[model samples]
Target: MPEHSRQALSDYAVAHTTKPDSIFDDIARDAQTTPSAGMMSGRTVGYFLNTLVAITGAQRVLEIGTFVGYSALMMATALPEDGELITLDVSEEFTSIARKHWARHPDGHKIKLILGPATETLDTLEPQFDVVFIDADKDNYPEYYEKSLNLLSPKGIIVVDNVFQGGRVLQQDVPDDQRSASTRAVQRLNEIVQNDERVNNVMITERDGLLLIRRRDAHLA
Candidate 1:
């Protein structure tokens, strides 16, 4: 598809989707102006995450990355009154910005922001998350997947973001070693989820890419 056509379709999709409130709008504006704006999950993905939380009725959510807390805010709003969400991030600066917006929202108290290496933090968490969202460093995608699976409830769902890696995952030969490593990690994650017999998965092409995996069960069938 032509770039223009694709963008038009995306615009249409966003237009028809559930709109976010003013708080999310403000956070999005800040994220765009920030130096690490690209790290933030955009509005479309935010809405999708919100919808997942609603549809699954997820009481507990675990987010591997919380860049400025855009996705966290969205998911938190969709949760029930007593629902809880724990978001992990390594940067205090980014989480600080997130805390500002979260403090103003009514559901903000439901979110717990943890600052530090996600891998170490994941080790401390118990297996009770109903939904897990992984959007952290690309190089650790496989490790995140493993840890997320271990932390999930029996009927839990895991959402993996940036599976496309800005279309780099499709490239057979990436000359840059650093970029190659990141791309290879994403590729490996896709392969691992695809072949894992413990779960059933589907990859969606919505902005970048989102891989939704849930345990294979008779109830699901």
Candidate 2:
């Protein structure tokens, strides 16, 4: 199938599930016009992030990727008045756009943008995130996943995006040129999650794919 067709299907699915908020729509517009636009996650993924934050009653959240900040806005809007979300992104330009959209909301103050490599940002954080969203560099996904789990509080959930790589994970004989470095890296992370004993996990085929992991508290071999 063509790439546009796949995106259409994904958009259709998301439309039926959740209404697009104004902040999300504005971010979509910014992404369309921006040079590095493709980094943004799909609306389906944003909806899932919103739902997960609300359902988990998460007050403190950590996001590994801000992109144009669609997902950050969605999750931040779900938080209570006292809730806060700290987001980390490496791109100064993209995050500048994110800050603009966030400023429009009354709860915008709840959103904090950390400009730096996510690994470095995660390292400095104190453990106790109610929810964690990982959607940054694919090559560092496993590292992000491990660190996110450690940062999560008891009963916290960690959501990892882009695990399916547009259904490429199941395909064999794909040309080396067509497969992305990130795709290969995500495939390895998928295996790690499947075998990990520290979390109860499930892979949902959303816009791309989402790995939902709830940290395990007990010691395991």
Cα-based lDDT for every prediction = 0.91, 0.86
- For residues 115-168, write the lDDT of model 2, one tens digit per residue: 998888899998899899999989899899989988988888999988888788
Q: Candidate 1 residues 113-158, lDDT tens each?
A: 9888898999999778989999999899999999999999888899
- Best candidate according to lDDT: 1
What residue runs in model 1 are displaced by over 4 Å at the alpha carbon? 173-179, 218-221
* Residue 123 Cα positional deviation in candidate 2, in Å, after optimal superposition: 0.7
Which residue ranges in model 2 land beyond 4 Å of their true spot?
1-9, 171-179, 218-221
- At residue 133, candidate 1 shows an lDDT of 97
lDDT score, candidate 1, position 166: 82
Evaluate residue 208 in candidate 1 and report its C-alpha lDDT on the 0 to 100 scale: 85
- TM-score for each prediction? 0.94, 0.89
